[model samples]
Target: MSASKMKILISGAGIAGPCLAYWLARTHLNAAVTVMERSPTPRVTGQSIDIRGPAIEIMKRMNLEEAVRSRNTTEEGTIILNASGKPFAHFEGGDKGGDTFTAEYEILRADLVGLFLDATESLSNVKYLYGDSIKSLDQTEKTVKVTFAGGSSDTFDLVVAADGGISKTRDMILDEHITKNCYNFLGQYIAFFSIPSRPTDPKMWQWYNRPNGLCVMLRPHRNPATVGAYLCITTPARGQQDPAVEAALDEGVEAQKRILHEYLGNLGWETKRVLEGMDSAEDFYMSRAAQVKLPKWTNGRALVLGDAAHATFGVGTTLAIESAYILAGELSKIQSSEDIPRALERFEEVYRPLYTKSEGLPPFFPQFTFPQTSWVLWIRDSLLWFISKTKLYKLLPADEGSGLELPSYGWVDIHRKDE
Candidate 1:
């Protein structure tokens, strides 16, 4: 495919597709790009996420750093409590890496997608079709023809899947030969929703952990209008993917609330008020905290990015931002159709290790605990509290930017006006 005439079709407009569209256009490609989403409009809301390290640097290149920073979920830090809401542990926020990093520059998922869509709207070669998905793909050496659910078909020089963890495209290409590695299960199911803020919890973020579940709260970033909750319910490994996954997934939003009510719901720290406010939320999200790993990210012209390639539960948004960043960076170096395979290979080679290196760390230390014996749990909790309060963590090297020796690549910037 000639650079001047290359046409590309991308799946999943959520984060990676639109983000890749923005960067591909910035490369001055004499080609055309289109993003097809399964939803009618771009996504409007989702759980909070962060952009850190080289991913943050990529945003700076795209000139979106300021806007992203402006939308951050300024959660000062997390407050851990007992059933009665007494303070047990506190983490002063910074780039201390791991869970605290999830709180860094956190923006609601839908907002991040909107930012990418808005940024690429003006590019002449870029187009987005919502409420549809690719139904079939027929690729020859020269071009690939994509059939959509809406009954339209199009041809392109290449197709990429950034649709996320449960990727249909990845499933098709691998043909069930490659099973996604479920690295470590957090033994938790998380659910969250946006609700009107109450007078009682003003500064944001309160969490409580018990044997079978955990509850967390946060005030929206500079938005006095709402608050958010992150609830995790523990389940046994054999119970992770039940036949009732769909029904259970739908129950996520209320499951946490219902569980909270059953557990700490009576403790009276504004629980009723928060649940009342949540009633008005349009949607509630729920899911198991399981990571997705694959033997490889590519099978011929098909390749996966973001969660589809390496879905890390409890990883928050930073990992997604980094995955998109690395995928796009490697792809930008491709010089021709023949160069594409190498690009995808290098992308996997570059990112998978970085992700592997971060495994086994706590999601929100002092605020969360794995399945430990009662004796071990008490000691670990105490140590976490002492370290958090005494600032002993400052002695350890922050887990920021400790990964790959990445190469520099030009990226596109998209910041809001005030930014």
Candidate 2:
């Protein structure tokens, strides 16, 4: 059981990759870890996400709680409004105000990534290669040979793809023919951006639901004069005609604003002001709701972790962080690559049932609803508002707490080993 020697290549540097690198290095001193990121640097802007229950425990294990808390969104709550700017309902903000925003740690996406990058940067055993990605993978009996876009290649004892759910590594290994529909398509498209916080705006979110597949929520930040806007398109599946696209599937800023205005325009409720800020912005994040599902997450010495294997919780950023923690713990339990497939199988076995449900309309929200132009947005907001207020919200498990019995970092829990 002397796991003193292990080498791993983890793909993606966002929440998961760096996390895995940290855990792997911590668990085995002799472990050499390298992470490859497609982006030039860590992402800076992302929606405010709540971390609860087990996930929080994992963060504490990584010793990142204080740093993570410092950058929290600290949302005070939000006011639901009509297209006319008339307020309808309100919801409480982050966990900073008791257990209202879920019984977990909540923070901005960028903040969490920044904390992780900072934690791993000084470790000589852990290396980060930004602006590059795996172009191909060639696996042999004892090693994984990977080719990178930067024309670099390396062989490792194991390869873990903590890359996001729409993982290119998954596509490379599983082959594109396997169209995975595990993602319960919430027919909505989301766009995240930063804009000015006007004096007229309160320290809360102002949600305007005009129907016709359009809903806008403005979340106020900790700083008085800054606010974040999340726009959701509930409508017909819109896309360009040329299907064979190679560019990043991201909707980008200009395009998202164009689509936003096309559907969410001129209804009032600070719409003009919000649109003005968004339109003037240089960048924005736009994405569809899709999850990744794999029949199995391992083939030989390679295993897919986090979103690359099973991405069910929609685009909520905290889920990605949680996935990283769980994967690291599971890997820590395994003795060698010989047990990798079993470890992956066990990991999926433990998590899938807790998340999978066959009730209440697939639990996936579609982007469009015909009567949405009416009061459906009001209803949805009202329900969320109610959940945010009452005990029902508590019933939605706060899985982000920092109390999970994880193995010691840089060392394995030999007692928990699989026989």
Candidate 3:
């Protein structure tokens, strides 16, 4: 089969799937690209996310940099506050391409996904399917046959899983042992929701750390009337999972709320208002922080992309965009369906080193940040205050961009001319 006529099926339309679809349609104009999302409709609710490093360049190549910047969350900077709501430390926002706690390209996840979807909407060969997911996948030497949850089956020349870390589609094809051992959970649980903005709320991100490893954060949103709230708790040991937290995760949102309240409800700095907002917040989401490191990203004609392949915490969005671009660029060089596997292998070879280097957290991460006692909290606060006052944060290394050289696949440039 001609590469341009190849049929590709991509699972999970969140970030990576739609992005890959857009680039595939552009690179091979006649290729049939289908993106399937499990949600019944487009999810427009998510916490703010940062786009740093190569992702900013990817946005420019796609002619989406200005559009993305127009939707910035408008977070001025970050402020570490004491229990009394007094600021103890402050960090200013960095430039658009600089790496900082609050990135210059900070925007909500839903907004970025919307931009990707919009970019692909005009391509006749790209299609989107909502409210369904893959039930199973069977891969042959030439193609992958996929069975859907809605009692339907289809065959495609290539199948890519761009689903998130806890990917069910990845489980259908990868070995059980690989699936079990790939996730490195960082003994932390976090919840994000939107609350009505108050007159007292500052434009900067307000972070309060309490005893017993509890932390609360309130950040500004693009919409001035609403603020984003985050609640995080750290367990005693790294990689340890709490039974109650696990049970709550399996249960519904109310159970999750109860667990969060049990841990952070009494902690003073704006806890009451945040919990009250949580009760009525429709977009509350909680998850365990984890990084996925797979031994191999491809098996036969099937492959996993983005978080399903390598899910780092802070740089996940950037990595997803960069990998999608590289995968599409490599596939564009192929002449026939027989070349798909080689293209997939080349992608892993070129990108795996970067992903491996980006897969770790800073030294003494969650434990050091979340103190369990008042003395520790004071010590941490004092250290932060000293750092901020001394302007030592400026000396820290900035995550400018991935050192990898991007390949030019000679694909058509679909960048908007009017921009």
How do the residues 168-191 of candidate 3 rate in per-residue lDDT, one tens digit apiece?
888776778767789888888889
Model 1: per-residue Cα lDDT at residue 11: 91
Q: By summed lDDT, which 10 consecutive residues of candidate 1 come out lowest?
A: 365-374
Assess each prediction's global lDDT (C-alpha) against the native: 0.65, 0.64, 0.85
Which regions of candidate 1 fall more than 4 Å away from where they truly are? Answer: 1-4, 95-103, 180-186, 214-216, 237-246, 250-268, 314-316, 359-380, 398-405, 410-419
Each model's backbone clash number: 5, 30, 0
**Residue 55, candidate 3: C-alpha displacement in angstroms:** 1.1
Error of 3 at 9 (Å): 0.5
Query: Which of 1 and 3 is the better model by lDDT?
Result: 3
TM-score of each model, paired residue for residue: 0.84, 0.82, 0.95
Per-residue lDDT for 40-154 in model 2, tens only?
A: 9777767766666456677776777887777666556656664467765555555433455323355767777788887777776778888999999998776789999999888
Ordered from best to worst TM-score, the candidate numbers read 3, 1, 2
Which candidate gets the maximum TM-score versus the true structure?
3
Top model number, lDDT: 3
Clashes of 1: 5
